[model samples]
Target chain A: MAEAGAPIIEAIGLTKTFKVAQKPPGFAASVRHFFKRTYKEIPAVTDVSFTIRPGEMVGFLGANGAGKTTTLKMLTGLLHPTAGRCVVDGREPFARTRDFLSAITLVMGNKQQLLWDLPARDTLRLNAAIYGISDADYKSRVDELSGMLELTDKLDQPVRKLSLGERMKAELLASLLHGPKVLFLDEPTLGLDVNAQVAVRAFLRRYNERTGATILMTSHYMADITALCSRVLVIHEGKLVHDGELAALLRRFGTRRELRVELSHAVDDAKLRTLGEVLSHEGNVARLAVEPAALVAVVGRALAELPVVDLTVHDPPIEEVVGRVIGKSQRALPNVVGAEQGA
Target chain B: MNAALRKMGGLLSVYYAYMTAYRAELILWALANSLPFILMGAWYQAAAGGAFGFTPVDVTRYFLAVFVIRQLTVVWVIWEFDQDVQRGRLSQYLLQPVDPVWRYLAAHLSERVARLPFSALIIALFFLIFPPARFVPHASDVLLAITFATLAFALRFVMQYTLALFALWTERASSLESLMFILYLVLSGAIAPLEVFPPELRELVMWTPFPYFIWVPARLLIGGADVDLMRATVVCVSWIGSLLVVNRVVWRLGLKRHSSMGA
Candidate 1:
């Protein structure tokens, strides 16, 4: 249900560079550089560009320092690009006009906007005031968000006293109180348990469905991508490597399938190896990795040969797929000097 | 303008609630800043009968006023700004519709709002213990002193905040702030009154904004409110204007060059 109307966020040749102090491994070099420093241009996000239509939830996949967060910051107007143009909702983000700021929200997991010593409810009200929300609107929004997130009981306690998961929920409430049209989420579900992750993912999906606000999210967790985002953008070494449907990206890069077999009795390792590369064997269950083409053949024979009670085939995990794709991109790392870096 | 002021009022109240919740910590800080009370006693012993045209009663009034003025004007925003830039906590504010300056300024002002009453209560207890400390000014003088104290607070805050923007370049900006703090202790009438200094040195120190930050307000309240009010207000306003201009320049440059490297 994401927007197909027009692009709300766009970046054209966005670039950012930092002057990194370079020093040799000696006290002499250190002292010399301290006096007359030698520096090099470490490009954080070099000539990157993309466009996000309204109501689209897109995932950004990359390794650490691969310019994922840098690109997000540039898009959010936190950093002025060293060389290019970025406009969000038809206004330059760096200008940070009230209208532009009110239309967008950036949620960074490492930083918080909540009052640490007060209740989350207070912070939410403070945000409402800052965003110029009326009392009726503020109350309705808080009620809706807190009810959806199942955090009604937790809003009254000090933020520091809440668990990690509750605090993240409160963060989501605080960020969404303004009814922003665009959301920039960087690792919003970091350091949470599986159940909490599922809750947050569900809330995000529901929120997107309800509000139709476009969301651009960067996450290391594949579940976050697969569960919430339909489209994905994979960046490696600060260059866009792939951008398409999540399933298609997985198929293009997901080379292996897992074969899970349930045998009547514990099987020997040798027999299991005859079918495919045995990943694990414990009791009557066995998981094996097989080529995509051989997946059916392997599962068919394993059921007939062994005293198999059940068999299932599933796509390879996303971590392995991401690693493989990033590895290939690293090997093909061309002399990408600031110019050929567009999506 | 009305909407912005209303928002600021709401923010200040919210932070006031936060301060109430964290009042225990504020109490500890009140106790921590009581080192000046000891210095007050030292001054009393050194100038037993009279010294430097300051009688025993003058010394008592000066330190009490110093204690209250220091409490009203001191700010830790530099340390906070340094940490925010270094740790990238500033991104949260940058994302919002408001300027981070107003948000932090409200926070700093609200904290003083919460803690000022506690300091006043302590001053009352001091008055009970020390008879010579009872020096109440006229209503107009109190009003003027309040305005001057506010300007003084703004000056010191802007100066520290503007310099703290240096954290965009280095992590040790607070170290520089520590040196400035030492100068305030010596010259701002925190350690000793400007009345006790040599005429030449005192004249020079009084001309700078440091004395205005603490000494003028202190003098207005306790030193018989006898000093030149017009010149002091002019100097405070001029200092505020210069510091605000520097802050705007530094803030722009810092934001341009900031990488927010850590987070």
Candidate 2:
């Protein structure tokens, strides 16, 4: 067993490349390709490394196809990395020994392990057996987890009959039945309603607090991250771009503040450009992007120079900040934003 | 050991519930394997002419036994395994401590349990429709036939599941099973008993695993089958063991190649 406070999840220079078949268009090309198909090496994840200590909830931030899921698959032993090493709970994940499997769980939002035709309880029973949870332990764990997830009343219903939120909650319960010390959740709140998302997030927080289990989650919903995770990892183009506190990510890409201005009279587009980069300009109102350090100067200049009715300065949304971090090139990222050594 | 039993029991009971949940489908699947009953007519005419060294009664009884054997030994792991791999469902099973094959194995076993009553009902209806085909076998013969039929199911499952493992490389691995199943139909006595084959051909077929699948068990249940029980047992066990070794090797390599797509 790993010592308390030790890193429960570690990835060192992990890399994964997939050989994808490329189909050419056209009749001649189709026949020729069928006979001798070509393949391209697509790098899904590259030279990524990070360490997550026990009980830390780390949000993995990335755009679609940004290797967040690929990294999770490697950590869960669902896919073997082409290069590098990963150890979860003191054992190689790909080895998938009984001890290692018992210590970790992977939950995917779009994919389910539940038996759709049967009650969620049936699958939970099967998982308990597979994980070697005794009958008494199984009952207690189910009671505890279902209560925590607010799904105690829905266990006996067929999974297909449950609401999407209820089904997702049950999936969480099934994955947590074994009391895994580490969780790799890929968009657990995907497709959930606002209230459902909140419920899942709260359940995860409570789960972490109660079990001290390390959680690494990826979600398109920024609310999921901001609600539960103190730290975040940002991956861009299969490379680790940023790894630190969530606030640091905002501060890094939070350089640009959105300035919304309302004017009493029409303002020249060219004159608005002088204050800052004009994002959008209308008859009298305009929006500009300005650096935080120059916010006061820009605001004062805008108010003095233009017939401003009202002006407001706001920080960019967390989604756009995280998006820029993921969408930017590795070269564009600040030098300090890389995998934390000795994390 | 007790924990293992509990796990097995859990898997079996859960899958049994899954199978029984679709009662109409269960009956339909049982009836789907009644190809032997359809083929009985053609063989019965040939036997009536004394061309196959048997009476008409022999043909009817043989095919009846074949129907029961087919019901017991039917397997579709290849389809389920192929879809699981292609859709990334197998990754969920791989995350657990137990081998994924046991889940498929349990499903097959549970389906068999769910299917038994229907098969028995169909058999009883068949005997009622054609009383001439009815015969009481010795207790020993029934026991041996059940044993061999059970082994036949194991052999068939291992073979198709081994083929299914290729889905890791190529998503449509069921095509391989389809190709092999063609050979099974032709040589496994599903179409006709081994008694109709020429002496040399019969000898060759006996050496293969095909006859042990249907002919050996079917003939044993109906009597008058000239089979070496000792040789049949050895061959069945050997094929199962050999295929199992190949299955494991393929499974390991398949896991390495698994992309876990679509999840």
Candidate 3:
């Protein structure tokens, strides 16, 4: 008999390498490749391993080319690891047995599974049949999902007619109709507005709570991680750098918090520098990076000495903390804006 | 019984929705298939009096049967497979409990059903003008024809699906399909009746599985059945069986290679 509360997914020393053909940028090089080609081994993932207990929701984080997506693909059986092994619910994902496939689902924001020309209800019926769900079960699940996602009005409409947010909601409902035990969601909220993002987040949280399904998700959105995941695994350049509590990640890399002070009068830059490291000063607004322990003292002194009108303290946005933890240079902070933003 | 029928009925309705969505493309496909009619006219005129012991009427019946068989057995697995593998759509099917082959088969059958009404109208018009025989066969011969025709369809589908598996290793699945199409066109008696071919060529065509796909069924429908034809029916069944085994093997091996390569 299986353990009642064991980890639903386990990986050991998983690695994947791709043989990328090397070709010069020219007609001559293209012709040469046609006749005789040279190839180089590009290691996309290396020696990364982790485990997830049943019902645990884990966030996967990494910069571009950091092997986050590749790792997820391996876990989901979409790709085979070049070295090492992974087991999802005691089955090898690469085998892709029908029983194994029926138990898991992968939802990609950029890739849609819903039939383009058909309505959501058609897809739902097709999936229900494919999963061998009884009619009563299928109906009840569909009804529940429709109510939760507000898809009742949109089920009969062609999927092409739905907006991106609406379409994603339908995709989610269709994918989950099978009552999968594991879900591998890759940027499930990639292009949705803030309200849509929150709705999806709320849905995911409730689903996880109610069903006790293991979820492995990767997102560039810090809000998603902060809101849904208590634990995160950070990878960089095909290597695992950190895997533990989300708070631990913050404590290790998020050593400083920004304190924005609105002064009643324009403050001298030199005086602010004496209070804390002056990050920026423009007009009566000044920004300072204060150590966590010094935040209270610094705020008190600034309020007592300077004509402060308003003040707010916040941790550096997750993007910056992640960048710093990955050993990216401070000068590269601006580039973080483009890394997995909003998703 | 009604509930079971309802499930099956619902499947067809969903298929209908897909067809209606692509109704314009269906019309274009019907137009493209008129090439066989053009060929039939050209051949009928050439055989105005007689050619190779076949009269113009015989040519008309044979070509019309050829047209119907060709349309019924039409499949484009190579293109579908290539696109799915390249674009990662195959993963979507993998995520489901249903076998991808069944879904592909359903989609293929649904498209055929959608085109049935238009095809029936064309056949009806041809019959009204020419008035060919209704082809009432002996009970045993009818059984043989139905059995062999079904096996032929299955063989053709599986063989093409197996060939499509080459997309896992090479990028020339379309070229491969073209080569198969040329072979089928020549060997399956789609362009001309096998009876018109030289004796030696006819013998060779009989030995290959290509003839069973179109020529055998069309011959059975138009030329009537023979007791000796049961031998050919057996051959068709064996071919289907072997091809099914080969299809499973190829699918398993190709999936292994694909997973390792991470396409």
Looking at model 2 chain B, which ten-residue stretch has the lowest summed lDDT? B254-263
What does the lDDT come to for candidate 1?
Answer: 0.82
Off by more than 4 A, model 3:
A254-319, A328-343, B1-13, B128-146, B225-227
- Indicate the docking level reached by candidate 1: medium
Candidate 3's residue-wise lDDT over A9-55, tens digit each? 98889999988779999999999999998989999988887788988
- Candidate 3 per-residue lDDT, tens place, B1-263, comes to 65444545555666677876898787666556665677788888878856567777778877877777766777887888889888988777776655567666767778888877777778778778777523444666445556656667788888888898888776447678899999898888788877777889887777778989877877776645432476787777788788889888888888777776765
Cα shift from native, residue B114, model 2 (Å)? 0.3
Question: What TM value does model 3 have?
Answer: 0.86
User: Distance from true position, residue B164, model 3, in Å?
Assistant: 0.6
In model 3 chain B, which range of ten residues has the least summed lDDT? B133-142
**Which stretches in model 1 have alpha-carbon errors above 4 Å?**
A1-4, A24-26, A255-272, A278-287, A290-317, A327-343, B223-225, B259-263
**CAPRI-style quality class for the chain A–B interface of candidate 2:** acceptable
Give the DockQ (2 decimals) of all models.
0.56, 0.48, 0.36
Candidate 3 displacement at residue A110 in angstroms = 1.0
How many pairs in model 1 have backbone atoms within 3 A of each other, for residues 3 or more apart or on separate chains, i.e. clashes? 3
User: Model 2 segments beyond 4 Å from truth?
Assistant: A254-319, A326-334, A338-343, B259-263
Ranking of models by TM-score? 2, 1, 3
Q: Give DockQ: model 1.
A: 0.56
Error of 1 at A259 (Å): 6.9
